[model samples]
Target: MEIVFTVLILLLAVAASGVAARLAPFKLPLPLFQIGLGAVLALPLFGLRISFDPELFLLLFIPPLLFSDGWRIPKREFFRLSKPILALALGLVLFTVVGVGYFIHWMIPVISLPAAFALAAVLSPTDAVAVSSIVGKGRLPTTLQHVLEGEALMNDASGLVAFKFAIGAVLSGTFSLMDASLSFVLIAIGGIVVGLAVAWSFGLVRRKIIEWAGDEPGVQVVLLLLIPFAAYIFAEHFGLSGILSAVAAGMLMPYVETAGAESAATRMQGRSILMMLEFVFNGMSFLLLGLQLPGIVGLAHIDAQMAGNVPVWHLFAYIAAITAALIAMRFFWVWFNLRLKSFSSALRGRRSKQRALDVRLISITSLSGVRGAITLAAVMSIPLAMPNGSAFPARDLLIFLATGVILCSLLSGSFFLPWLLKGLQLDGEHQRQRAEEMRARARVSEAAVRGIENAHDKLSTQLDEADQALLTEVSGSLLATYRMRMDAESDSEETHRVANRFKQFERELRLEALRAERQELHRLRAQQEINDETFMSLINQIDMAETWLLGSLSSSN
Candidate 1:
């Protein structure tokens, strides 16, 4: 019962935090609001405390979020930016682990090199979710945003794998560079393979089931929700990277959707469910970090004692040093990587127009490397005792430092990112994307118009004169709509504006009619003029129509 209450409270807190974020006077990130609420909940007055279980937390929250990111990320952009993403995710993670590991060891001699490496490894993975929350969607330049998203997706696995190796080294008193490298390759590849296989198998099964039992949205949604968890578990069972498996499953999901095997209802419902889950889970993750902060802080004295009876402020200084070191390392790497890319391009006789180095972009990238829940989870998972039963060295101090770093990073990003991003121009990228979109929309509308005309011509011969007239009229209406869309995508700004205005008027009129229809249905139900089932069916039809109207309106704008 207590456990149940705790879960309920956390869910309520997640909900409240979201509302609070929106209602706050100043515009702050949602994660910051959630973390603040969580911290308040941990106060002595509330007496709310939950034990942090790293394994369970990862299993419960990480997979679906990663999967959703993988599923929705712009695949074209991800592939195009793959070089930079790999450099940051794979190369930077290794660099951070080594660089920060030695820095941590040198700064604080109490923490063993292996344990310090473990800390740095966990810190290497940046939380793109946190970054996204800090900077709203579509605010960052599209290319940079895609690179960051891709980096976040891949680095979670790489960072955690490194952390695993470090922890093993600490426990077993053994280190093997050659074996670990081979294992890393195998683990990463194996996870990707397992994810692809699982996703493909699931897609096949889903198709067969739909054929057998028909497309039921409820059942389809439930099955969709299971894929990430299944991928993670299956990969882990084979000693692979579950994080990558989940991401792989997500990335494969879009292809499954492209099959167009399910009804529109299934797609809509699945999207809604996934969106809600992402919000709630993401909020809970930051909230959990906040809740743990007080308890972690309470142990500062003990950590101070463990660090040779040093003052607690020294721990904070260590955190500041580590955080600064990370940002510096990221800035240096981004600068060097860009410079190297430019040099390679020059050697290859490619004249890139963009500057070789953009300081603003580099600063944004550096600050965007904010750590969040994953670091907390990974550091907390450090084993309490070694194989010989001795306590893990500086365990409390390690957790303290990790928790501090997470807070510091989040704060730093919140404070400085907006300032760095101000007046930054990515107008060229935006204009290119807008032009490409207009072309694509125009092409699609043309195809739709053609399809409708072909269908009408084929059916006209089978119909009598009156029926043929009816078919022609219906087809003409759809063709007009498609033609209007094409007109809206015209190169002429004036022509596009006229078409868009007509679309807006049409949408508004349709929505008004839908609302009236809904009201009539409700009136009939209240007066007992219609049966409940009939009223419900009619209302659902009206609601779906309204939903489509509003969705189209928003998309068009």
Candidate 2:
């Protein structure tokens, strides 16, 4: 009952955080509000405390969120920006592990090199979701945002893998560069292979199920939700990188969905359900962070007093130093990559401009490396005892430092990112994307119009006169709608306006019809004219129609 109540309270807090963030007069980040709510719940008055389990948290929360990001990220842009993203995700993670590892060790001699490396490794994975929350949609350049998303996806695996090795070294008191390198390769490749295989197998099974049982949205959505967890577990069972597996599964999901066997209801409901899960899970992550902060700090203070009478302020200083080191290392790396790209372009006789913009972007990227729940989970997983049956060196201080860094990074990102991005003109990329979408829409509409005409002509030849007339009328209506949408994409202002008006009027009428249908269904149910199941089925159809209608209206506008 206590455990159940805690979960219910956390869910409520998650819901309340969303509303509070919206209702707040100031534009504070949603994560801040959630963390604040969590802290309030943890206060002495409320005394809400739940035991933190790193492994459980990672298993429960990380996979789906990462999978969703992989499924939703723009594949084209991700591939285009793959070079920079790999540089940041792979190269920079290792770089930070070494650079920041040594820095932490030097700054605090109490922490062994392996322990310091563990801390730095965990810190290497930035929370792009938190970054997105800090800077609202479309605020950053599209390319930059894509790079960040891609980096976040890949680095979570890389960083955690490094953390694993670091922890192993700490426990075993031995490190081998060659062995670790080979293991990393095998782990990464195996995880990727496992993920792809799992997703593909699941896709095949789902297709068979649909063929056998028909397309039920509820079943399909539940199956969709299981992909990441299955992949993660399967990969981990083989001693591979579960994080990578989750990401790989998510990336493969787009291709799985390309079969076009799913109904409109499945797609709509799946999207809604996935979005709700992302929100709740993300909120829960930050709330957990806030919930752990007070206990971590209090315990650290007690440990500090017992260990060496180290000041609490020294821990804060260490966090600040480590945070600065991370940002500095990241900035330098991004600058070097940008310079290398520029040099390559120059060699190809394509001299670059916008050097100043590159600097600003580098700064933005550095500050955007805000740590979140992953770091907390990783650091908290540090074992209490070593092989010698002694307490792990500076374990409490490590957690304290990690928690402090998470807060610092969040604060810096929240404060600095907006200022750095001020007046940055990314309109060129936005306009290019808009133009490409318009072209695609126009081409697809044209193809659809042609298909409808072909079907009508074939049917007309086979039908009697009255039936042929009905077919012609139905086909003409579809063709007219397609033509209007194509016209809305035209260069001419008058044609676009007229076509948009037609679309708007059509959408309004359809929406009104859907509302009437909904009301009639409710009336039928209230009067017991229809059974509950029948009413629900009919109501769902109406809701799906309205959802599609409104979605199209919003997209068209």
Q: How large an RMSD does model 1 have? A: 1.6
Compared with the true structure, model 2 gives a TM-score of 0.95
Judged by whole-model lDDT over C-alpha atoms, candidate 2 comes out at 0.89
lDDT of 1 by residue, 1-557 (tens): 99999889989999998889888899788888988889999999998989889999999999999999999898988998899999999999999999999999998998889999999999999999899888887778888888999999999999999999999999988999999999999999999999999898889889998999999999889999999999999999999999999999999988875289899889989999999999899989989989998998999999999888999998899899999999999999999988887888889999866675778899999999999878888998999998889999999999999989998998899999988888888746777887887799899999999899899989998999999999989998999999999999997899899999989999989999988888888899999999999997888778888998988777666
Query: 1-557, model 2: which lDDT tens digit per residue?
Result: 99999999999999999999999998778888888898889999999998999999999999999889989999988998899899999999999999999998888877889999999999999999899999888898887888999999999999999999999999999999999999999999999999989889888888988899999988999999999999999999999999999998899888977288888778888889889999999999999989987788778776566436788777777789999999999999999887787888889998787464467878988998989878888888989999999988888888888888988999889999988888987747778888998999999999999999888888888999999889988998899999999998999999999998988899999999999999988898999999999998988888878888987877665
Q: Give the top-scoring candidate (lDDT).
A: 1
Query: Which lDDT values do the candidates have, in the order given?
Result: 0.91, 0.89
Worst 10 residues of 2 by lDDT: 300-309
**Pairs of colliding residues, candidate 1:** none
- Best-matching candidate per TM-score: 1
Span of ten consecutive residues with least summed lDDT in model 1: 426-435
